[model samples]
Target: MSIFERMKQGATEAARKVEQTVEISKLKSQISTREKEIDRLYARTGKAVYDAYSRGDLSRSETEVMDYCEQLSDLHEDIKLIQEKITNIKLEKSCSACGKIVPVNARFCPDCGKKFPEDDEKPQESTVGEIRVLCAVCGTENDIGARYCVECGNELSPAAGDRSKPNDPAGDSIV
Candidate 1:
């Protein structure tokens, strides 16, 4: 074949390969989307089963499902604890009157105008040597006077501790 003809043939073959690659990428994307949809459907089905178990509609005779339900319960508790830690890190408190989140230092709830108690006015102080000062961001135990966490280098609050006071009505405790 002539040099020009050989070059044309090579160009056509390269074009075809590019088209095939594009098509394969499109197919893979569609497959990934379908897989995500399937995962969501499975989650919904699991939620339905868990709801039934919680309502006493499903008995403990099904040991497999009971185990799954127990795992879900533990996961839910873990989620709650993590959420409380997040709230503490944000220095926020829920208003008792309206359940609206407000700044920890606020004397009254901005949304509900509910006055916070005297003990809730400020973050409770950490008694030196009596309690451990843990970094809220990294959960690393630090010395009472340490300004930052050693493990993650996250800043530790001076008043960080079990914020719950003996007189706190809600009796909220932080770790």
Candidate 2:
């Protein structure tokens, strides 16, 4: 092939890969959203079922509860499949200790500090975003949106500029 032709082909291939990566990221985000929805449905269904039973109301069957459970199960399965695809695309592996995904060539798992077995795959760019917030107390990295530290249960304040300190009228005075 001519040099120009080869260059054009490479550029097209690169663009295709970028589009694929974006699609995968989108799928991962959707999976996260779906999982949250399943949690909400679980809580709602539980309350509905409990309220019905506590009131001696047998009019409502298990249909709603069954549906919620089925949906949750399906969402979990879909998440697994999407995770598999992400792992395949990123050439990553799940940490044995914590189940957190890490690059295949990593020597130590970032989440759990578990050492990884030596592998042949060279390290590629991490697919995970650098959006996690570090816990001030325990130092465990939590989601940027997490309101509480997952490891130590400490209440997290909003990021800088997002939270305002309590106003002190006296402290603000000339004293």
Q: How close is candidate 1 to the true structure, as a TM-score?
A: 0.35
Write down the lDDT that model 1 would get. Answer: 0.57
TM-score of 2: 0.45
RMSD of 2: 12.3
Model 1 ranges off by over 4 Å: 1-61, 124-175
Best-matching candidate per lDDT: 2
lDDT of 2 at 134: 71
Model 2 residue 44 CA deviation in Å: 3.9
Write one digit per residue (lDDT tens) for candidate 1, span 17-109.
587566656655655565565555557557767877888876543565566566556555655665565556556678788886755665554
The regions of model 2 sitting more than 4 angstroms off are: 1-17, 57-63, 98-100, 105-175
